[model samples]
Target: MDTRYITSAAKPEQLPDFDLPELAFIGRSNTGKSSLLNALLGRRSLARHGRTPGQTQMINFFSVNDKVVLADLPGYGYNVARRDVAKHWQPMVDTYVRRPNITAFLCLHDCRRNFQELDERLMFMLGRQLPIILVLTKTDKATRNEIRKQKEKLKKRMDELGIDYQVIIETSATKNQGIAELKALVLDPHLQVEDENS
Candidate 1:
């Protein structure tokens, strides 16, 4: 019923060896990924809170009830002067995205800014492979009217992309809204296995 932070690892090989489903969280820098994680778990300081925009350079793994795994992926966005450190991210992140255990990816985009060129490019590279659920972050900063308008815009984009089983969810980690529905859609059934034990 509740999700919690398990661990943070730098390398993919260090990820815990378990067949449990993995719900990965990904987004652009300053898109409220860390805050959303804490909000989803109903805790304030569960995931490392960082002030720097592009702070999550390494991949973080969080376990949920021993049956599911929540992976906190590094945020993708331009960080002036620190570009070299993130050189290895896109490729490595792509691999993990394509991995079989990746039940679903929460591809967050700042609602204030429409999805960017980089986001579009990554979506193309993914090539209809992994199931992705787009999360519109930072709703608390916008007016209700503005949020609805953005949702319509993003919906049109998804339709144009022909992405199947994809969904767009609006959330404000600060407001604690849309957290439950997002979890239900991605984490619950996406990774659910037909019980072999059954």
Candidate 2:
């Protein structure tokens, strides 16, 4: 699939006009959000990766196959100082989430750590509108048993909260695991139909 960088918006009003279906990826800082985006698009550095956490401070958009738009939202829950920055960006995320064109959310979580409070809050906020595909990132860094446990734990939490989710996928950008499934989930019309029906 062909993909190109679009524009970065600090606020919702600054976002470029686009009518195509949009899917957004969001997670905590250093949670492999950029890496997963690069993997999905089959590009090495399409979404720039930074050494510092909370480096992505704006809402970034990328056009894929001229059919769908992929949004790389700023990561949340970094540190006290960065948390303040995240507070400023939260409203922008809220506005974008409410946009009519956004079809779904690819919510990434680090498989190595237990789900944090920020992840729960984010899920609560986004789950109300769009169908979310919970992605467990950096799965290669964890053992199979650990991955399975984390998935079950997260699924239970999501179930308890009554969050709307399509699936929980384990991914390792380095290993190229779950990249195809993630792409299918994002681009497959049949999956969207099934999600809407569900």
Candidate 3:
């Protein structure tokens, strides 16, 4: 259960050589990505939580039990007014996800808000290549009925897009919900074996 930050890369060339299997976490800014990582690792500060949008601008990597890597990719769809700054993230993220040794992708979305067009586009792009685990974060902020509605809406959109049914998890970092399920997915033996064979 040991965890430690490895490095933060701003570009593809700056990324460390991939040796262990990696499960990358990505989402829009302030989608509880950092909090979820901390909850999963049982650490209070593995990934820094910030109030500011686009606080995590680098591709941060962490080693878990020295067996696998967890990459905290920079959040997208932030600072829409600064199109130039936000534009660079697409290429960087695209390159990192395409890298070798990536086992799966965890795409987090805030349950309090409706899924945006950008989210759909990103999911569509990533879904085409990797096994995507759609995580609905901040569920504690919404009521049971609201959460159910949000899940249904997202599923319908995915179905329309021909995205096969994937594991969709509802999580609340404050409530410690879905943490175990997420950990199970990340540490699944099949994924580890896939990395070993690759």
Clashes of each: 1, 0, 0
Worst 10 residues of 2 by lDDT: 189-198
Off by over 4 Å in 3: 189-198
* lDDT tens digits by residue: candidate 2, 1-198: 888998899976897878888888998888989989999998899898867888767888988888888999888777426666767687787788888788888899898787777788788878888658888899889898887777777778888888888777778999999887878866763364332211
Displacement of residue 14 (Cα, Å) in model 2 is 0.6
Model 1 lDDT at residue 168: 66
Error of 1 at 184 (Å): 1.8
Off by over 4 Å in 2: 189-198
| Superposition error at 9 for model 2 (Å) | 0.9
**Which lDDT values do the candidates have, in the order given?**
0.71, 0.81, 0.80
User: For every model shown, what is its TM-score relative to the native structure?
Assistant: 0.85, 0.91, 0.91
| TM-score-sorted candidate list, best first | 2, 3, 1
* Per-residue lDDT over 71-189 for candidate 3, one digit per residue giving the tens place of the 0 to 100 score: 99887777555777667776788788887788788899998777788887888888888757788899889998998888888888888887643578888999998887778766762
Candidate 1 ranges beyond 4 A from true positions: 191-198
Writing each residue's lDDT as its tens digit, candidate 1 over 1-198 gives 566666766665655665888777877778888889888866788777667777667778876767788888887775524767566675557567767777776788888988677787666555477656777888889998888888787667766876543566778898887787766654574543221211
Q: What's model 1's overall lDDT? A: 0.71
The alpha-carbon lDDT assigned to residue 43 of candidate 2 equals 88
